[model samples]
Target: MALFFFLTAQSQNKDLPDVGIIPKIVVKAIGVNTDIQGIIKNDSNLFKTLSSELIIISNMGAKNASKAEQKDNFSIAPDEVKIVATKNINVADTDNIIVLFLIYEDEKLIARDRKELRRQKNDPNVSDGLEIKGLVVENVRSKVGKDFYDYFYQQFTLKNPESDQLVKVEEQLGIGIGTRIQIKVQEDLVFESFARPNEEQLVNLANSAVARVLQYFKQKERQKQLLRQF
Candidate 1:
């Protein structure tokens, strides 16, 4: 018998996907073999049915620096815990070993976790997103506004993806038959439009809104960082 320890590292920049499906990884040492299980969890307020890949990567610290990897694809839904993977690995002589777990949703990297005997390698550098503040307030008073909002919500959450931010979508009666729409980040206005376009246009409109909002926060972040140097 030998002594071993497992240190876990979670996703740093992102959380459970906005779609609400997240993967949970479990590891247990059974005799000389390592047991790894993958579980999916669906959180609140979002309805999503998705298939994802659960990847298990292990670093065997040896002369060759070899790595072992296993991947499996599975479908998951709300409130259901489907066993994605159960892998049994044999740990060799040295105690220095690392096991990394990743879950990808619709080919998009969504959640990850790692269990290690010790911190041998730094977690892969994940690009950080600007933390957003304020509440996401929607003022949809008409059918047009509602249509735009639907398009915007789906686009905004996926494109580039903000870490912690709230977006306020406001609508007002335009001077013409169309209605006015605007996106506000806290008090700063990032996107505004008065044209009442069709559904096709709404897709573009949503994309633009997502871009403007990200730009607004990104610029503010740069300014804050610059001021901090003083």
Candidate 2:
């Protein structure tokens, strides 16, 4: 597994100083018999499963005043992996911006590859319009009883596809298997939802969580714009 992250920006309107910044995350999976397609088609919890099987080590540095972002859309093929990077992430001028990637595949226990990227400086002030801190699964419980808690816990925990950040989750008593997702920007909550713990439900949970995050930022930006008029 190998991945790269790129941060760049461009002007959308010539009249205004507003810039459009877009960052990209690219990944490539290589193996003799890697079941990439099967995972995508069969398992609905792709991100969660992958996170369990592989540990992605990533780091970024920017000389420019900017923030990096990850896109919501994710797809993978045997050939390569590509993803939208950031709207706020800035790369510094006169210095080589670096993003290091280290991928490890579980079960196989093979260290695949490591990559370091140097990106050019670009405008960072403009809004990329994406502000999703991360997604997390929490408050796992079994409605029936504690007997099936471990089984459901294994199914409910999910990885935030947009970012590699994990927070602690606590066990709670419940009448059935279910989880609540809390999307956050730093420590502030942007969105939250509770749902049954199943494959289809898990899918809905992730999509709904992402939608809330996006909507929260959109409304926040609107409020900021309204205040600027004053």
Candidate 3:
């Protein structure tokens, strides 16, 4: 039986993913209100399921500025800019996290037609006459969460020691000996607003924010892979 088990273990080891020590990661969710809070709380179960998962940072908030700044003749910084408000949530099972973020900066709010143009024509520079730039809100919960999960999953299956007999023996022994995992995160509110003739700018900015989060994950994955080779 021992010999039979040894042979089986050697064969199984060959098929196991070459994953080494599970890489540590920093999980961070960026956005205002529902987008950030809802996703983290919703995936609380998944976090618990992953044995080595560490939520280094979560529920970061930012404040939006409500004033405008004039730069070069062609460009204007939105009056209201979003800035990070606070640190990550510490307690577990906290729900409905409310995080305020800057959605816009200083820029002139304009109307589509001339109906209101006459009123502003006489007082183009009037502060009261100027329109308020709409508030920009975004949710970034799912993007951050999924990125962390996928990266962890890939690392787990890729660098760990492979041994069929060892796996079976470990199962029979009922001992837990596997890869170690860690996580860390840094959250920041980035500006993605435009004072233009269309709404496409805001959409593009939000997309950019999500892409940044994905890029962060990919970079970390590469680091982990390099570490495993040593």
Candidate 4:
């Protein structure tokens, strides 16, 4: 099983900005009406701003399996939030969900977020419990391994403390085979090193791993921007 941790601010990737689907469900005497909007956020401190070419695709669905979608373009400055796509649907009930997608340059998918629209009848205190996760560590053992884990944690935390970046330090062990360490960011392996190296070597490996992780994310950011230019 994969472990879960949460770095708030954006999607599972720190490379792209955040696009959230905010749905307000109103219960009428006859049926229900849902108003959903896409809230795009850009953290200039961590990422670049999204210009007018950014497209937000909003999808609204109900328990009856009916789906509706809206698309629009938007621009948001760094350290700013703007509402993009607005979709109002007459849903059958409060059992609904909104999925907002950010398509960069119409070809690449940069980011997306989802929210459930629900209401409990006659229960005003019902809460829609949502769980979010960030930064995961896997199968770390022994003092050597612990040292590596600690170092990677400190370095990554300092680099991206407020990003929803999923980080994993996976350890592979078996009989007669060399152990393996793979540090991954957003499901992409950034560094795979240090089977059974010495303590000093392990520290160095951690340093490389952290640097590779950051470099990988930085490269992703640049790649998306290049896609936008052409």
Which parts of model 3 are misplaced by more than 4 Å?
1-198
TM-scores of all candidate predictions against the true structure: 0.44, 0.34, 0.20, 0.39
Assess candidate 1 and give its lDDT. Answer: 0.60
Instruction: Please give the range of 10 consecutive residues that has the lowest summed lDDT in model 2.
Output: 31-40
For residue 46, model 4's alpha carbon misses the true position, in angstroms, by: 31
Most lDDT-accurate candidate? 1
Worst 10 residues of 3 by lDDT: 1-10
Top candidate, metric TM-score? 1
What CA RMSD would candidate 2 show?
14.6
lDDT, model 4: 0.50
Model 1 over residues 1-230: C-alpha lDDT tens digits? 34344344445336555555555555545444656655555554555544444444444545645565667766555544455677776654434556566666667777665545532223333111111222255888888899888667544533434334557899997766689898887767889987476876776887788788878878888998999999
State residue 156's C-alpha deviation in candidate 1, in Å. 1.5
- Against the true structure, candidate 1 reaches a TM-score of 0.44
Count the clashes in each prediction: 1, 14, 35, 4
Runs of candidate 2 exceeding 4 Å displacement: 1-6, 9-177, 186-188
C-alpha lDDT of residue 26 in model 4: 16
